[model samples]
Target: MVMKTKLLLIAIILFSTSSFISNRPVTVFMIGDSTMANRSIQNKNNKERGWGMMLAGCLTDRVIVDNHAASGRSTKSFINEKRWERVLDRIQPGDYVFIQFGHNDEKEDPKLHTEPGTTFDDNLRKFVAETRSKGGIPVLFNSMVRRKFYCNENGLYTDSLIDTHGDYLLSPKRIAEEKGVVFIDMNKITHDLVKQMGPEKSKELFMWVGKRKDDTHLNIKGARIVASLAIEEVGKKIPALGKEIRRYDYVVATDGSGEFFTLEEALEMIPLKGKCTVLVRSGQYGPKPPFVNKKIKITEEKGVSWGSSAAHAEKPLKNLDLYLCVGQSNMAGRGKLSPEVMDTLRNVYLLNAEDKFEPAVNPLNRYSTIGKGLGWQQLGPAYGFAKEMATKKHPIGLIVNARGGSSIRSWVKNARQSGGYYNEAVRRTKEAMKYGTLKAIIWHQGEADCHHSEAYREKITQLMTDLRNDLGIPDLPVVVGQIAQWNWTRKPHIPEGTKPFNDMIKEIPAFLPHSACVSSEGLTPLKDETDPHFDAASQIILGRRYAKEVKKLIKK
Candidate 1:
């Protein structure tokens, strides 16, 4: 009681702005060999193990990494043991499953060895199919390289970090490309990481204590570093799971003065069904710790925000209606905040530009002067769109990833490598799905690309198809918003930019199943020629239109 009182006193003096997250933690199902598995302590010399042991520590508390990897189990043996069934049985929607197995498969044991592109590919397909069947995303990885440096008794190191696993790496790469699933080249990533450590220093990473040089298994330090690299890959290629890494803290407050304080407070007033973040300014409040249970997570930043109330807490994401908001400035949200819009918002949530889930309020996009004057007033269509669905069976959430002035060409997956705008958007979408079902992808582009009206339809269709393929959503519904017609376009400023683009949008539903486009025909522009985005009032109707179209698809 004394210790508890001390903690409560700290909570009051150093005010805590608690945010109760509504979703379940994101679970990472890890299936791999000894390189990525946990091992039992055999004896005093049992310091050797897999990197999976250190994965959870590398990740935030929200990510639950369930490592089912074993010492000698390959993909073939893992299935033979019926372990794959156990993993699939509990697999649910919005879960991430990782597979890595090659070391034992490379050995002479016929029971475990799998031919790179044949049996290996076959086994991988089963994992992918099963995971997708349960609506869970499957990720593949190659086993880490052994720390076998080609050296003699002269201690002359040469050709370090050799790829002994042979076609094992090739097999996973082929499967990933063939199936369009996310694949992490653990062998390549860790090999490069280990090579940087050098041969002598690299020994510290392997199971080489004093004299025992078992280069296969990694020690605590090696495992931790290797695990860190593997996780880093998780965020790199499979961005959806990457955003949930929780590498740092997000401060929330009672007063709307922090990065996410406003969104958090808005949800607090309502019976928020999922998690949102916030930070409050200093004020006179009771000196008592929140009656926290297993669901709550309390954390403190460097105490930089106003007052000692710079507390942050969030769990892994789950169980919400996740949407993807992508496109140009209008989609970036130029709509200003209104009282009606704010008041009507309920369990609406958004995955912010920062990849954090907060209450979906106005300006669900971004503003240049963030944490500055009038910045908090930024509003957008996501709030109203999500709110319209709040009364439905599920809670509402949006992954907002839009820019002010980007062309359609920039959204192509190949083009995303250099600028990374499209990749970031995909990453945010994946993060949002960590907690919720991805119900729809909302796009409001074309003003910038409207000039290329001839290629507009094909570009739109191709991008949508590739996006679905990569995301493993074969028939995910797409809701596109048509660009507003400006007087300049009518007066021939750029005739191709307006009517042609709008015409293409009208035909989207005809070509794609479960797809629809919302019109801005009756909607008026912001009226500021210098800024031709939708006005605050018009955004409400636009959002509702989007909701109606998505709802129709849901009903169907």
Candidate 2:
């Protein structure tokens, strides 16, 4: 009897030990670039703290934050200097590594740079392999943007950094995929947040020293915001550590009255039922709004389909796709759509007020569609792409995550490559799929990447490859639109300048696989000179072109 009792005690002890091991604290190790590194005393004395420092405060005691990121280290230099090797030596099982680099990688100087070709990607894979070997998870973040501070005629600060970092941001993402690692695009999130803040207030987030234009590194406040984003990202992949997540929250709304809820109120209201759209109202919602919620639409409207009151007790909706769209003015969907085209796409609903609610004054109805500005709108390309998939049609959902007038660099996940626009598109794509499967990715970019013809092909290829890998679908179909003919050709601006860049775009599709390019060379109307955006007529054609390419890929 005594022996049997001792054996039972031992069994219980072993079980407890196993459980403890399984639920260990998530240790996050950050690597790469000055923006993420521990800034020098002089730098910190000036109130500059890298985003990694502020990120430490967001995690509970259970999560450990160790940042080994260095200042001005490119992919090649990081490896040659054995910085990553030092990181690899310390990594343990169940650990997480967040890598953000690329700013310095694009340097033309061979001593300090890395070509976004095989070398850049190869170094990334090495980091992934070493991390995994130690049973650690690797997360890739594209670089952040440098604040250029350009505004439109209306004084709205348009994010233009995407143009600068387009090619630089693609390398790490492609490497993340080839290495089977997770990626978070910090570049895009920060850019959108800054743009939302507008030019004036956005300056407060960076370390703007004397004559330096310190857009590359974040101050203490900026670091905290970025760290919060990283924490939210990790919570998506590993739910066990969610308790330690102090930065973000997940909520559902049951009132169905189109009323908005603060982050605090939403958290207290748990497990909300019925079909409801989590409304993010039209007012400027900043990064501090506790955006880390799950299964909520974060919308602005009260009525219409997928709105607040649309959800009833009888019908419960499951699985929602939230998209984030960011680009130049075209992505903002300027100009009007013909009534005929609007009818054909009737299933699509914009975030406008109903006739009954605002008969005399429609507050949100001023714009031609919900696609104007950044708001939660119905699935556009994702919906169309899913519709094309008749046989394997999954529960169709989309998150319209986009921003206009931004360059590709604006969206890069790495702080070094901030303001890179494509990175933002990638981040939005990942965010959109959190609720469901991403059938296809539709991209309409090239004006920014066209500037540097020498590296454009490699950059585009890497961007597509990285996007596919980040979403966990390696061979996903990617559809891109060719740059439309601009009216600059009609007027005299520069002679050989535009031709070289425009001509290089024709060769992008040739290098990529399972990718199709839509021709918008002649789609725009002759009269639309002031605005280079596609008219309603052009959008239908463009949408059709996207659909056709998607169909062709699906058949294969």
Candidate 3:
């Protein structure tokens, strides 16, 4: 409800060295049923956030996420309410029209019901024609998959997924193809993800009340994940719009390893007399210059304030996908730095105790309990995972709070933490959320809990529950990294009863709702000796494994 709409102005525009300092903002206007609607958090729907609400987290200031979708509205009802007219009135060149529907349209009632090929197809054509009339691109997305899996007698899933919104899915695809608009298959992607998550875990990605499950609507985690899936598809189907989304930037760092050594080099390349705009950014690029230079003038930017740089604004990009990595030794990373990992830097970043979001380097679990959150162990799974998440064009932020020798008990709310690890984790999580939305938590700690294996499940579950409540994100998912294998390692290093402990870690999902486990099977530990920590390649692969599992918890 608060985001701005895009406007196409003449080319002559210039702002500070910001990404996409164009004539107008790129607007993405969404229209559909309650599944894609803008929800009010002030009432019963407080916990129910639609995918549109979280869409902003995936984009930079160059684009706008303007959601006009409403609940319980079918194609006929939307037209009658003048919702489509209001969206049409605001249409501009270079703007996008994202259309999705069907939940309310299947009703037997006349006002809500529309036969797929007849009324539904015709209505969809109206939207495409009108959008094209305004020189706007139109993209159609099918309905999302409901979290309905086939279950056994004990309430566990026996199969993958079940088809709930049947013919509705077919209608949108046929219409998009026939009308020559971009088509995004959200249902297929979400259906596969739901099946992979199974029955019990899939419910966490939807709205589940006291025995009343609204699989059609999503909670905050569900919304964010679904939004990511939609945008990813949008990027694929609409490549030009995808390029504007993010993943590339003109960064002029203080060290001068960037595209330009000085702003003068940047300005000299651009033609300032025309309507085209050039952005100039710097970390410590000396004295400021006049706004207008030979017909060039500066314009106020969205992400860039009057005089903010990368160090000051913390590399503002409107919003970022933030994850908190907290656990023990393996999470603290003990791998040797690999040369390949050094070259794997992109949109991934780490938030340190100093509150700066810098380009993420390995040994990410530095909480002062180990080392600085920079240049350690050569690489961690956080490196690969952060890179994976950022590849979608969203700025990814990681908050590190791992301790080397901490047990599951150390993560408890009132547990004994000599270094205040748990307390510091809570403090940092609360602080980091002020800068970015708390997406999920990546955890890896079980080697120390091996000795006290009896209390492992309860302590770990309590840790997750407490963290979510304290952070005010009741459904925040936890990605548990199953401890590395130590049975094959040299004699003295392998701890007693290691197999059972790892098996117990694998069963964590049965006791928890939104949590998922990533196996460390076949992962090679440190060679020449037998420590539980993973080696450079293993840690890198393990981070991607954790990332792959978390992708299921969040999206497909």
Model 3 RMSD in angstroms: 24.7
Top of the candidates by lDDT: 3
TM per prediction: 0.44, 0.40, 0.43
What 10-residue stretch in candidate 3 is worst by lDDT?
8-17
How displaced is residue 61 in candidate 1, in Å? 36
> Scored by CA lDDT, what does every candidate get?
0.65, 0.53, 0.67
| lDDT, candidate 3, 365-389, per-residue tens | 6433333222222356787777677
Error of 3 at 319 (Å): 1.0
What does candidate 2's lDDT look like per residue over 487-545, in tens digits?
Answer: 44443555443356556555555677777766676677412443445654565566566
Minimal lDDT window, size 10, model 1: 12-21
Please list the Cα RMSD from the true structure of every candidate, rounded to 1 decimal place.
21.0, 25.8, 24.7
